[model samples]
Target: MAGLAVGAVVVLALLVLLRRRYVVARVWGHSMSPTFHDGERVVATRRRHYRVGDVIVFRPRSRTTDVAWRIKRIAAVAGDPVPAWLETDHPVVPAGRVVVVGDNTGHSEDSRQLGYIDLAAVAGAVPHRAAPEGS
Candidate 1:
């Protein structure tokens, strides 16, 4: 009986933490494939400071469609150096925004296509998978 009570408390605490720190999202394309497959579920923490190469979930400001969210890796963060390889004439990442891209470049619509992502829209880094759990 004591073990059951302890298990319930642990589960409840985890749920509360998750509820406060993360928001659930679902991936739906090959844009981030190989890393995140189509129809894969994702959880991103609440908006916080992020660095380059971090995967984030955000809403694109340049998009006019009803699409809700997008998940991609941050290529550049506010005021960070933009590599010469990016092929952009404007080299530095703008303030309060980030340049994002997908693992699957060929199929992704990222900073390469649209403009930088607003920091205000960023949800936060996607949590790392602890194990090879199935989708």
Candidate 2:
């Protein structure tokens, strides 16, 4: 009986660790279509460094949408030249900031609309697709 209790406690601790190191969110818009579709579930691994072309989940500073969180692809990172299409005053992305955009640019409300995202606002990077449904 004591062994069973210890095993349960061990499992609980691991679960808590995993939760702190990862984020699971559901895609809600066509902004990332062709890559992540609406209604799809995705998992992101928490990390400190993110680079261009990496997909990430973040909390938007703007309240343009009702959703609590958003997913986008990194277009540029700190020290990189800002994309000309985005009308920012800075010639290059400032430190501790990143520019993100939707895969489907026409339908995305991304860096073009929200400006540079603070690294602190990011939840994590989508390292891979979510596990198969119902697994």
Candidate 3:
């Protein structure tokens, strides 16, 4: 009985902490190459808003899957004019949206391929990285 009560408390604490803090995700592609490599685990803080140059994870708009998470760099912010490539009258990054793209243009599928992601879709921003082996 004591163990069960302690377990329940621990679970509740985790739920509350996760709701207010960050999450961890393992990078799976080369989209953020050089900065974040495949197989790397990244720590994402959910409290802060994304800014230019910050690496963020967000779900893309897609038909086949309910969620499509990707890690990319924040290229623009709300109220900014749309880039020449994006054909939309709305600001590229509206008040609740973020414009993200991969550093490796050659192989990344990002905002350049899909479109801006809602701020709610942003899981968090990458904060720390583990050192590479032998480094």
- Candidate 1 lDDT, 1-135, residue by residue in tens: 999999999999999988778878788688887788988988898865887767888888766655588988887887888755466767688789888888777898888777778888887679753211231
CA-lDDT, candidates in order: 0.78, 0.88, 0.73
**Candidate 2 C-alpha lDDT tens digits along 15-86:** 999998999988998988878899998898899899888899999997776887899989899999999988
Instruction: Please provide, for model 3 over 15-101, each residue's C-alpha lDDT reduced to its tens digit, 9 standing for 90 to 100.
Output: 988866776777777877777889887778884566777788776667444334678877777877766666676754578877776
Q: Which ranges in model 3 have alpha carbons more than 4 Å from their true place?
A: 1-4, 63-68, 128-135
**What lDDT does candidate 2 reach at residue 55?**
91
Sort by lDDT, best first: what order? 2, 1, 3
Please state the error at residue 76 of candidate 3 in Å.
0.5
Count of clashes in candidate 2: 0
